[model samples]
Target: MKKQTRAIASTLIFAMLLGVTACSKKNSNKSKKKFSVATQAETTEAPSETTESTTESTTETTTETTTEATSNPLGLKIDVPQENCEIQFLPEEERFKYDMVLELNEADHTVGGHVVVNFYNNSSEEWNQLCMRDYSSLFKEAHHDGFQEIEVKEGALTEVTNVMNETTSQALTCNRDADVSVLWIPLDQNLKPGEHMTLSYDFKATIPLVADRYGLSDGVYNVTNFYPILAVYEDGKGFSHEAYYNFGECFYSEISNYHVTLTLPEKMKLLSTGVENTPANADGKNTYTIEAPCVRDFVFCASENFKFFEDDYDGIHIRLVYDEAHPCGDTMDACAEASLQAAKDSFAAFNKAFGKYPYPEVDIVLAPIDAGGMEYPNLIICTVDAMYCLTNSYESFPYEQMAIVVAHELGHQWFMGIVGNNSGMEPWLDESFASYTEFVFYEYLGVEDEMELYSRETFDLTKEPWLTSMQANGILPINRSFYDFEDADSYILAAYSYGKIALYQMEEILGREAFHGILREYVHRNAFTNSTSSRFFGVLLECAGQDNADLNKLIEVLFDI
Candidate 1:
């Protein structure tokens, strides 16, 4: 979630943190597709009824009563489990499963999918109806994300039809929200707690021709958030409500397992969130089998004219899929090399600073995307075309704009991918942390002058041209929801620019060693679970010292939290 306006000069690097022990062995490999590096565990919760406000029931005014925890008398979202491990996965019986079979039509830019979602009622209340987010409908409108170049011409939705209960073999009916992306499917029977229900449905998605995350640009197809995903259910509230906002990410879901078999044109190269097995070609079609366990969401970016460049770091294979022929220039090779090195640096730094990345592969897609960059689970799409690619090495780099974007997206691997959060509500939890990792990138790489320049402007919010006003504007600055922001510029200022500065100031308050150590603990405790900005504050105060009210005062002064 990088701001598109990052063309700062990159000369100096701060050798602040101690150098990590990294041994690189270069090998010219084509993806070298590796699979099954992470353990399969954990499932996510369903949704409950809540308003469209930024303050949901989960993160509310708990000042009157402490949060339910032993160490966390504040009752924060993160509570140290009795048996904490590197991977705290939910039991298989409690985990949800999505078995999908899809066929991609390259000619039509449409995907015909048959999805079977096996849901387990883990909540205290019985589920009467199921909810999902139809993000594809957002693309059909006349407008799109402000920064993105859009062409929305009608074909963007597929009503969830042929929904049948796999357990009882009963046909189902659904209700669609005309205004928002929320879809409500009334259940025939009440799915009680400890009960397992299997429902299958048929859907067809039309990939609009746009330079956005979920669209068809040139020959490349960015298929993301395109499915009818189950909304997270709260305990007291009904299914959580999240409308599609063009400003920031509004996706919220539980960690689940995906077993998918996709049939597409053989010429298209695929890069997805999971470990993909080699495809079998038949009748000019490539049918690939992919599996991703304990992931929040599944996405893939496919194209017919993608060239491959690859390298391996820390046993994880890194693949660079670039389309340099159409719309993209020839400097893609240089961008790939720089982007791969940044990926390696990101893995090393986040491994030491937070925790080890729990995946076998990472894919970097350098296409002609509109915005800065977008991050999925294992794949990241960065738009580095013509005037974009700064031909330079990572060590003595002059302009490190590409590396900053790549590092920010990779930072989501830890914040958004590994540790989950409600992006619509508390975007600062993920976007700002991702932005803060940019500083960690320079700090780890010892980009002293570059770090100084970036940190200076980031700390001074008025310097950013997008932030039109220095006033608070009556809205909760960093703590507000996506719907709260009037425009994209204000959202970027709060989530991207100001949020990272707050964390950096936190590091300055507590020495770097303590700060990094606390983050490592935070990720381990909250891995595969959703976190809140308040919980982050509680963790900081819990680790540093609750006696110090400096953080409380800082939030009041800076972000008006």
Candidate 2:
């Protein structure tokens, strides 16, 4: 989710970095390390998985064809090369895949689905059992009957585990509740490294009517992390079974291919993570199929009253959907255009500085929420309040605020979406990069002065006073898990505010061009893989020159390592 005030605080700190003359002396000793920008010709690659053909119209017909087929159901050309379309970081032998079919009941506010997973035991040790997370339980805890009826189909040997209740002590602060998210599936055979296994299960849940990520709110159904996804299995550390925290994202998953079919009422409009393929309508229900490769997660939003608009920029299709009766209708239309333009402009800037966005389209939706925004792989959900100032005059909408949120979420398409990181552990890796990208957006627009004023106003209202108040209370280290923070405010301050400041300081030491070059190289090397703080620091040190003790010192101070 977008940390609205934190973005402004980060931009203000970046502006402060420009005036730090003391850091100029260390920059004269340039490193000899070479970094080259990737050419457009190098971006084309084939998908690692085989393509399957499916029917798209009302009559459900089946056909066998490759992605090279000239005509697609959507009438849009499938021109992105297969290799460039899918993530190439993982070896074919070690890749995991998911095939799911979901049916949505709009009247009951429920979803029923089944997923088949082909999982590879990539870890070195033999495994006796596997674990997956049941995030819907978190929602169930609050609205007892609302998020109910999750069954692991009779054929699957999976059961809910309450191991946390049995093993943990009272002193532990995180995830102390009785409802555990981990689901243990006993393996009939001991699976060794490089071995593959297939598992299938059925699940159903009632969507809560709340203004949160995974729920139904204001006549729109927002589905995210609703299905049971495989938990990350660390080589030496075992499966990560951390409970879902309330403040920040606690999700960590490997890039995988997805084939999802959602059956819903015929009149509902849908926006999902992947590209929509052949859709068929039968009786009162419509079946929509989507195929996405190399995405970490899949999500969708459906509403019968949504008004849709479309545009294209730099070979990427951009679309916006919103409720027509919204209080900020006129302003939202204007903000949507401005936000989409900002996103397109930022994409070009980021592609030059980092890496190209591999996806074919991006969907931006005006969701009914009171905060900033939320980011998915190729989709972004911006809150209504961020699109327009609710209390201010309608003539002057919150275009700048909406633009910052749009650019920030777009930045995640690279930092978090393409270059993966553990959000629960090191959220700064993505949030800080996203915040810095917002600064780049303003710089690209040549509105640094306007950004400064906006930043100052937000900083004054939130960070400026909070920092002074917390200075006496002692601040936590910036590089730590979300659980380490005392509250949402502390998390925002450390992860978003201080985190971007650290990057901006690093940018000051290395020139802007060199800094951008380093990030570009980093994204290229670590695309579709999880990155750690050590590897990030090592890359910086290598590019800045090992002999540059001052840069290392600054890193040590900022990251507290």
Candidate 3:
């Protein structure tokens, strides 16, 4: 989910130690020269005139909509039509929605929550049980003392048990595998198809002091995946009970509407996934109500020392939250406007190439993060280190790194946020696409030369070497589960590096216009739902001409399918 650059020789030596020799003999005949820097025609040429005309038309429509929606172009709010905001990609009957009330205790860094979910049985088969992912328990299992207490308040369940709760006194009847992030609640009766059921949960958790998706670092509190969320269910496959993988995303869910209320200290400013309504202050605390429509997940960040800045792009509100004491605080403040504009341009280019971004606002926050950046539905967290490097007036610092990170995360607003994927199984669906989108963003800005330089340094120079080394060592294919890799580094090489290479090879085979057309169709079809590697390959085969033997060979080489 984040971009990382490591040395080449070290990676190869590590891969050899793992006994990855499956592809060694096959790769022996291949020359490294085949992975040379992209040619001028491939990297710097402007898009075709048709693509330019399409961009202009889309920009015009966006401008008209922006003008009609707001008198002040820089306002912090934009009104989007209800129907346009719906998750139209999924069937109307299958949508699941959530109503939650969460109280954050700033003094103790704890959260207590109550959530009511209206889950529709969209599958033809009847349901005998429901499963929810307890992501916070992963922290507990890692020796962090955070507690994830879940009690079923309302549902058709005969009994509820936290199969992973080691401290609970409940009778242990369920299996406890090495992966223990699921809560199994059995239903008293089989829920018929086309019927709906309401399930409510009361939960509590402590915020760990760590640099992760859900934790408190310094004075900022980041809360993500802190609640028990319903797992996506298949008729015959049941729920995807993938264990939490620390290296990559292991969670998957359907798009759902969220109405959340958070009670926190009055002084704390909150930036969350949804639109915040007017806050009510009472007894030294403020209760904020946020409403998010058709989103896969909800996250929030709170800081009493946070400063806020806002801008607008085509009626979409852009806000940045940062602490002045942060290492990149001054840099973030100085570049906030430029960063937001870059994001807008990125969105425009993505919309022109893929599909329209179906949200009215996006919030970018500079925070302490474990990665270069992380993306939610309408929010992105840029790491303080990246921001600092971007702003540092040093010759050694890579100034373009910050822009690439921002663009990559914003790319996820479409890739992972809207067009969903099981990141644990097919991380390339988001990571590789987002990485490729960074190049697209650069191309859209008429900075193809810069993109080429970046690509050479990142992919061609650094990642290609490691990938070649891995290929020579016969490493695992890119399409495996997240935890199947030896470590995070291997996953990054497989998912991000080789994944982007595969996409680029495909683009080279199919012209740019045709490649983008396929991507646009993919977005149009998969928005608000999950996509698999097979479906992606099917789309590629459809657009790239299935009879193309070279393309088929490339796919086989990359995915080993």
For every candidate in turn, the CA RMSD to the true structure comes to: 10.5, 11.6, 11.9
Candidate 2: worst 10 consecutive residues by lDDT?
Answer: 30-39
Candidate 3 lDDT (Cα, 0 to 1): 0.63
Local accuracy of candidate 3 as per-residue lDDT tens digits, 1-561: 554222223532332222112112112343122112222222443332332243344334533442112132221122212211222334445568788888987666677677777877777888777777867656653432111122211111112233221212222233323545687666655668877777665777666667666678778888887777888877789878876654467768889888899998898898988678668999999999887767899899988888887754434566787776676656555555545555656665676677656655677887767666788888998766653445473122222334556777898988899788888777888888887786566555544432332233354422456557766544447777666666556677666655665676566566555676667656656778888888787767665566787677667656745
Instruction: Point out where model 1 deviates above 4 Å.
Output: 2-90, 144-150, 389-399, 449-470, 473-476, 558-561
Top candidate (TM-score): 1
Model 3 Cα shift for residue 452 (angstroms): 6.0
Query: Per-residue CA lDDT of candidate 1, range 304-388, in tens?
Result: 7888887666545678888857543555566577677777777766766876566667788887766678888888988664453
For each candidate in the order shown, give its overall lDDT on alpha carbons: 0.68, 0.62, 0.63
Let me know the TM-score candidate 3 reaches against the reference structure: 0.76
Worst 10 residues of 1 by lDDT: 34-43
In model 3, which regions exceed 4 Å deviation?
2-92, 141-178, 386-399, 450-470, 473-476
